[model samples]
Target: MTIAPQRVVTLHYVLNDEQGAVLDDSRARSAPLEYLHGHDNIMAGLERALEGRQEGAELTVTLAPGDAYGLRNEALVQEVSRAAFPMADLTPGMRFQTPGDDGPQIVTILDVHGETVRIDTNHPLAGRTLHYRLEVLSVREANRAELVKGHPLSADVAASQVEDRKVP
Candidate 1:
C-alpha cells in the first residue's frame, strides 16, 4: 500500500552532510527506520517527501536547517551559575539532559568557569543541511496498538508489552 496517515512506514536511509560526508546509514546498522506516517514521528520535510510513496520506492531528499533540526537560536546559549549543576567534574563538550519548558532538552557544556558555566540548548545538528538517500521497505496500515502509541512497534512485541509502555 502507499504511504498515508495511520500507516506504518519502514525504510533504510543513508544520511549525509552538505559536503557529502556520511553521517548515518540504517543499512549498516541492520535495522531500517520505522515510523507512523502523519504522526510527527519523523521530520516534516522527510514525511512530505515520502508521502504517496509505496514499498520499493527509492528517492533522495535534501533538507535545509529549518526543515531538519531547525535553525540555531542564539538565545539558547546561556550561562548559569556553576552551582546549578549537580556534578562537580564539569568539562567542555559534555552533554546533560535537563527538564525544559517544552520537555527534556539536551544541554551541551561549552565552557566551565570558576563561578559560571556556559551551555547551549540547541540540538547538535541545528543549522546544518542534511541529505538523505531513502529506500522504502514496506508500508502497511498501523495496528490498533501502534495507532494508540502513535508510532510503530516491533513485530515481536506482545499485547501485554504494548500495555506496559508509558504512552501518553
Candidate 2:
C-alpha cells in the first residue's frame, strides 16, 4: 500500500551529512525505523519524499538545513548562572536534555566561566544539510491504538503494558 496518513511505515535508512560522513545507519543497528505517516514522527522533508512510496521502494533524498533541523538560532545561545546546574564539573561540549518552552530540548555547553555557563539550545544537526538513502521494508494500515498514539507501537507490547508505557 502507498504511504499515507494512518499508515505505519517500516524502513531502513543511511543518513549522511553534507561532508558525506555517515551520521546514522539503521541497518548497522539491526533495527528498522517505524513511524506513523503524516504524524510528524520523522523529518518533514523525508516524510514528503516517502508520501507515495510502497513497500520495497528505495529512494535517496537530500534536505537543506531549513527542511531538516532548521537554521541555528543565535538567540538560543545564552549564559545562565553556573549554580543552575547541579553538576559541579561543568565542561564544554557536554549535552543535557532539559525542559524547554515547547518540550524537551538539548542544551550543549559552549563554555563554563567562574559563575556562568554558556549553552546552546539549537539541535546538534541544526544548520547542516542532510542526505538520506531509504529502503521501505513494509507499509501497513495503523491500528486504532497506533493511530491514537500518533506513532507505531511495538507488536510485543501487551495492552496493559501499553497503557503504562511512557515515552521519554
Candidate 3:
C-alpha cells in the first residue's frame, strides 16, 4: 500500500540541522519509525512530503521553523517563585511538565535566582530549521484499532478493543 491517510508507514530517517549536524537517526537504532499517516505524530512538513509515497522511496526535505517545531515565542518565557518546586534545586536546562487545560505543557528552566526561576515554554527545537533524510521501509493499511487511536495500538490493546465492541 502507498503512504496515504489512514495508512501505517515505517520509515528510517536521519534528522540534521542547517549546519549538517546529525540531530536524530533511526537507522542507527535499527528501528524505523512507524506511524499512522495524517496523524500529528510527526512534523507536518515531513508527513506532507511522504503522502502518496511507496515503500523504498527515499527523499530529503528541508523545513522552515514554522513547519517544524515553530518559531520561538518570547512571551512563553516567564519567572516563577522558587516556592513552586519546594526542596528541589532548579537548574538551567531542567524541564517540568505541568498539567494544562488541554494537556501537559513542558517548560524548561533557563535561569535560577535566589527567589525566582526563569523558564521557557517553547519546544527545544523551536526557532530552528529542520533537515530530514527519509526512506520509506514499508506501508500498509492501518488496522481499525490503530486508525481509531490516531496511533499504533499494541496487540493487547487491539484485542481489548475487539472484545469491547458490540456489533449491531
RMSD of 2: 4.2
lDDT of 3 by residue, 1-168 (tens): 688989888999999998999999998998889888898878889999999899999999999999998899999899988888865777799887888776777889999999998989888889999899999999988888888789977668878888889686
Q: Estimate, for each residue in 61-134, the C-alpha lDDT of model 1 and write its tens digit.
A: 99999999999999999999999998889999999888999878899999998989999999888999999999
What is the C-alpha RMSD, rounded to one decimal, of candidate 1? 3.8
- In Å, residue 165's CA in model 1 sits off its true spot by 15
For candidate 1, the lDDT comes to 0.94
Look at candidate 1 and give me any clashing residue pairs: none
Who wins the TM-score comparison? 2
Order of all candidates by lDDT, from best down to worst? 1, 2, 3
Q: What is the lDDT of residue 87 in candidate 2?
A: 92
What lDDT does each candidate get? 0.94, 0.93, 0.89
Against the true structure, candidate 2 reaches a TM-score of 0.91
Model 3 stretches with alpha carbons more than 4 Å out: 163-168
Judged by lDDT relative to the true structure, which candidate is superior, 2 or 3? 2
